[model samples]
Target: MTAQQPAGGAAIPQRPAVDFGRRYITFETPRFAGRTPRRTMIVCAALALVILGAGLASLTLGAYEVSFGAVIRAIFDPASDPDARQVVFEWRLPRVLFAVLCGAALALSGGIFQSLTRNPLGSPDIIGFGVGAQFGVTLVMIVLELNTYLWKASGALVGGLLTALLVYALASKGGTSAFRLIIVGIGVSAGLGALTSWILITVSVEKAMMAATWGAGSIASLGFDQLAPAALVFAVILVLTLPLTRRLPVLEMGDDAAAALGIDAGRTRFAAVVLGVALIALVTAAAGPISFIALAAPQISQRLTRSNSPMGTLPVMLTGAALVVVSDAVAQLATVPVGVVTVSVGGIYLAWLLAAQYARRA
Candidate 1:
C-alpha cells in the first residue's frame, strides 16, 4: 500500500494507538519521601502492640481467668505456680501459639498471591488451595489410614502444590489474566470441597467425626509436639519467602515493566506461588483450613498502612497473627472452632468490600 500524502506533500505514516488497559495499572513498594523509616517503625510498633495485646487476651481470658501478670509469670517462671503453669504453659499456650503462627502463614500466603495475580481476591483460601490441602489431610486420615502429623503435612503439601500447578497452567494457557485465574480457582475449589465432603461421608462414623472436627479448623487440644514441626517449617519458609517477595511490587508493574527492571517476572512468580502454597499447606496441615484469615489479612494490612502496594509483608503477618489470636479467644467464649469465628467475621467484611466497590463504581 502506498503511504498517504499530507497537505505539505510529504508521505505520512499512520500508526495504531496502543492500548494500556491492563499494563497501565502499576503498584510500587510503599515509599515515603522524608519520614519513611520513622513511619515504618511506628507502624511496626503499632502492629506489635496489637499482636501483644491479642496474645495477652488469649492467655488471660479463658475458662480459668488467669490475670495478665499471672500469665506472664507462668510463662517465664513455670515452677512458681503449678496450676497457673498448667493453664498457661501446658493447656492454652500451645493452641494460642499455633493460632498465631498459622494466621501469619496464611496472611503471608495471601499477600504473595494477591501481589502475583494483581488482584485483591487472590488468596489461598479463596482460590481453593486451602480446601485442596484439607482434602489431602482428609484423604490421609480416612482413605490412607495415616493420622500422624507428618503424614498429614505431607498430604497437604502435595495437594496444595498440585492445585497451584493446575490453576497456574489453566490460567497461563489464556495468558494469565487475574480474573480468569480466580474464576478457575473457584471452580476447582468447589470440586475439591465436594470431594472432601464425599470422603467424610464415606468414612466410618468415628473417623468421619474426627475428620469433621479437624476440618472445622481448631487449634484446640494441640500439644507442643504438633506445633514444633510446623513452626520450624514456617520459619524456614519465611526466611526464603521474604527475600523473594522483594520483587513483588516490581512484578505488579506487569511482566514487561518488571523485565525492564531486571526482574525475572516468571521465575519470581513461580517462586512466590511455591512459597505461598507451602505456607498454606503447612498451616492447613497443622490446624486445618482456618478460613478467611488468608483472604482478609493482606487487605487489612494494606488499609492499616494506607499503602497501595502489597509490600507490607510484616504488617500483614502481624495483623494476621493478631486476628487469629483474637478470634481464637472469642471462640473460647463458646468453645467453638476459631475457623467458625473467622468465617463469620470474614463474611461480613466481604460484604462490606463488595458494597464499597459498587459504591465507588457508581
Candidate 2:
C-alpha cells in the first residue's frame, strides 16, 4: 500500500495482474466503478421508460382499440371504461404483467442455477427444465386433465424437481462438477424430450396438436384468470429467496468454506436448488416451458454489469424483463408465438456459450 502525499493525492495499492489460467477476470469491488450515482439513475430511468413505453405500445397495437391515454388512465384509475377497461384490464394488463413476471422469474432462476453450479452455462431450460415441465403437463393432459390449476401447477413443479434431482443424483458424488451436470442434464433432457415426443405421437392427433401448441410457451389469449394465480405463486417463491443471497456468496467459497461459516452447506444448497426449480416450474406451468430467459438473462447481465459473480437481483430482473418484452414484441409481429422466438434465439446463445466454455478449457 502507498500512502497519500501532501499535494492532495493519495497512492493506491498495486499488485501484479494474475490470470484464472485462461483469462483475467476483474470487476469493480462495489467501489470505484466507472458509473457514478447520477449515471446509474439516468440509466435506470431510461430503462423504465423503455419498459413503460413498450407496454403502452403493446396495449394500443392489439385487435381492439385502446388509446395510449386511455391505457394510462385505466392503469391508474381502475374504473375507467366498461369496454376499454376490459381490453386493458382483462387482456393487455395480464399479458404485460405475465411477461414481466416470467422474465424476472426466469432470470432469477438462471442466476441461482449458474451460481450454484459455478458455471456460466447453467440454466433451467438448458438442463431440461422445459422438457421436465413438458413431461409433467403431458402426463396431466393425457391421463388426467381434471386437476385444478393449483394442482396442475403442483404437477409441473414435481416434474421439474424430479428431473433435476435425477440429474444431480446421477452426476454428483463427492463434489458437484459443472461439466458433468451439463452432460447429465443434457442426456436426461433428451430422454425426457423423446418420451414427450413419443407421448405426443402415440396419442390422438388432436391431443398431440394441443400438446405441441402449448409446448411453444405462448402468451397469446392469456387473461387475468390464469395470470393472477401464476404471478402470485412466482411472487411467493421470489420473496422466500431474498434473504438467501448471502448464502449464495458463501456457496461460491466452496462447500468447506460454506460449512465453516456456520451454514449447513448441504441444507443451504438444497434449499437454493428447490427455490430455483420452483421458480422455473411456476413459469413453465403458467406459460408452457419458456426456452432460454433463464439461461440467457443471467449470462447477459453478468457481462453487462461486469460483475464477477452471477447476476444479483436488480440487474438480472431488468435484463430478463427487457429480453422477454422485446421477444414478446417480436412474437406479436412475426405471426408466431413467443416460444418459437426464444427457442430459436436461445439455441444460438447456447451454441456460443458452449464454444466459449470449450475455448476456456482449451
Candidate 3:
C-alpha cells in the first residue's frame, strides 16, 4: 500500500502497522491502503458527470422553461438576452452552484468528523455542531438585530468551534471514547437548541418568524454574492484539509497506537473538529442550517463504496451534491423548505442507521 517511498515519508509519519484479524471493523484501513480502488474511482467519475448534468438541468429547467439552447446562449452572450441571462446565470446558476458548494462542504465535513470520531452518526446536526452554528445565528438575529451576512457567518464559525471544543473537552475525560463523545455532543446540542428556541419565543413575533424561516433554510432569493464568501471559507478549509488525509488512516488506530505510530491524536482530532465545524457553520450561515445533507452524504458515500476507512472525500462530496440538488428540487416543487426536506429524509436515514446497528449487534 506504500506509494513511492520518499526520504522523509516514513520519518514524517512512521508507516503504521495495522492487521485485521477475522472480525471486520468498518474503520479499518483498506487492504488496498494508499491506493484507491479502480471501481470506486470509476464510480466517483460517473457521479461527477451526473452532478454536472444536474447542474445544467437546474440552470435550464424552471417555471419559465428556458430551452437548453437558450440557456447556453444566455450563458455565453449575456448582453444578447439580459433577462434570460439574469434568469440562467445570475439566478439559477448560483443556486445550482450553492447546492454543489453546500453539498461538498457538508459531505466533506461529515466524513472528517466520522473519521475522527469513528462514528457514522457524527454529523454536525446530530452531534451539535449545527446547533452551535444556529446559536451563533441566533445571537446575530436576536441580540444584535444585525443579520448582515458576514457578521452572522462569523458568529456561526465562532459558535461552532466553541461548542465542538466544549464537547471534546467534556468527552475526553475517559480518553475520547467515540460513544461518550457522541452522547455528550447530543446533550450539548439539545441544550443549545432549547436555548435557541427560548430566545426566538421571547423575541418579537416578526423577528421570530424571520429566524424560523431562515432556520428552516431557503434559497429562493439568495444571490451569487451571498453564497460566494461561504464558498471561499470552504475552499480555504479544504486546502488545509488535503494534507491531513494521510494522517487520518493512522489516527484511526486508537490513541495509544496513534501515538506509537507518531500521529498526534489530540492535534489531529482538533484539526478535524475545527474543519468539520467551520464547514457546517459557513453553510448554516449562508443557507440557514439546511437539513440532513451533512448527515446523509457521508453515510451514503461509505455504503456505496465498500473500502470505507471513513470514505473517500470526493464520493461524500458527490453524494452531498446529489442529496442537496434532489432535496432542493423537491423543496422547490413541494413548497417545502430545503432544511425541512433534508430533515425528513435524514430522519429516515437515522432510523435506518439505528436498525442496522441493532441488526449488527444481534
Candidate 4:
C-alpha cells in the first residue's frame, strides 16, 4: 500500500487501525512475556476490592461486634484494646485468610479441569474429585483412626487422584469426550457419596458427629495452627502449577495440534489432574469439602471478563476469594456452615448455567 498524497503534494503516513473491541496490554522481557486484556485487568482489580471489603465486614460484623476503627487498630497497632486485638487477630483474622486461600485453591482447580475438558461443567465438585477427597478424609478419621491433619490430607489427595483416573478411564473409550467425561464423573461422584454415607453410619456417634460437622465444611474452628501449614502447602502447589497454566490453553487446541506445537498433551493433562487434586485435598484437609465455589467462580469470571476461554486464572481466583469470604460472613450471621451457603448459591448458579446451555442448543 502506498501513502496517500495530499493537496500539498507530500505523502501522508497512514497509521495501522487499532482493534477497539478488545484492547490488550502486552509485555515482553528476558524472563517472561505475555498479554492481558484491559477488561480482565479491570475485572480483577474490582474483584480484589470486593475481597477486601468482604474481609473487613467479616472482621467487624461478628457477634463480638468490633468496630471498623478498632479492627484496623487491632491489626496494625500492638497497643490496641486487648479485647479487640484478641477478637480481630486471634479469632477472626485466621478464618478470613483461610477463606481467601481455600477459595483461590478451589477456583484454580476448577479452572484447570474446565479448561482441560473444554466444558463449563468440568469442575472438581461436579466430577467426583471433591467427594473423593471428602471420602478420603472420612476414611482417615473414621476407618483408619488416623485423624491427624497429615493423614487426612494424604487420604484426600490420593482419593481425589484415584477418582480422576477412574473417570478418565471410563470416559476415554475411543477418545476423551467432554460429554462422556461429565456423565462418568457424575456416576463416580454418586458412588463415592454413598460410600461416605455408609462410613458415617458405621462409626461411633461422637466420631460420626465430628466427621459430619467437618464434612459440612466450616472454617469456624480453624485458627493459626491450621492456617499456617495450609498456607505453606498452598504456596508450594501454586508455584509448581504456574508453568502448567500456560500449557493448559494449548492442550485445548486438541492433542494432535498441541503435539504439533511441541506440547505434550498427555503429560499436561496428567500434571493438571494431579495438581488440581492436590488443591482440592489442601482445602478439604483444612476445611471439609467447601462446595460450589470451584464450580461457579471460573465461569463467573469468564462471563464478567467476556472471554471465550476460561484461562484467566488470576481473575477466577479473585472471584472465588470474594465469594468465599462473603459467604462465610453470611454463614456467621445465620449460625451455619459456610458450605451450606455456598451450596445454596451454587445450586442456583448451576441451574441457570444448565438452562442457558440447553437454550443455546435448542
Q: Which residue ranges in model 3 land beyond 4 Å of their true spot?
A: 1-35, 76-80
- Per-candidate RMSD, Å: 9.7, 6.0, 8.0, 2.8
lDDT of 1 by residue, 1-362 (tens): 44788888889777767763322223455683332434545666887887778777788867787998898888788467789889888888898788889888999998998888888778887788888788888888899999888999899989998988887787778477988999989999999999888877877899999888888898887889988888998989999997766699888888898899899877898889889989988888878889888888999888877767665678888889989988998998878999899999999987887688688879
Please tell me which predicted candidate would have the highest lDDT against the true structure.
4
lDDT of each: 0.84, 0.79, 0.81, 0.91
The global Cα lDDT (0 to 1) of model 4 is 0.91
> Which prediction has more favorable lDDT, 2 or 4?
4
Off by over 4 Å in 4: 1-15, 18-20, 26-34
Predicted candidate 2 versus true structure: per-residue lDDT over 169-237, tens digit per residue = 988886668888988888999999999888888888887887788788988767788887887787788
TM-score, candidate 1, is: 0.87
- Residue-pair clashes per prediction, in order, are 0, 0, 0, 0
Candidate 1 global lDDT? 0.84
**Which ten contiguous residues of candidate 2 have the minimum total lDDT?**
34-43
Summarize candidate 4's per-residue lDDT along 1-362 as a digit string, tens digits.
45898988889888878766998989999999999898999999999999999999899977787999999999899998999999998999999999999999999999998998899999999989999999889888899889888999999999999899899999999887989999999999999999999888887999999999998999998999999999999999989888777788888888888899899887888889999999999999989989999889999998999977676778988988999999999998899999999999999999999999999999
The global Cα lDDT (0 to 1) of model 3 is 0.81
- Show pairs that collide, candidate 2: none
Q: Candidate 1, 207: how far from true, in Å? A: 1.3
TM-score-based ranking: 4, 1, 3, 2
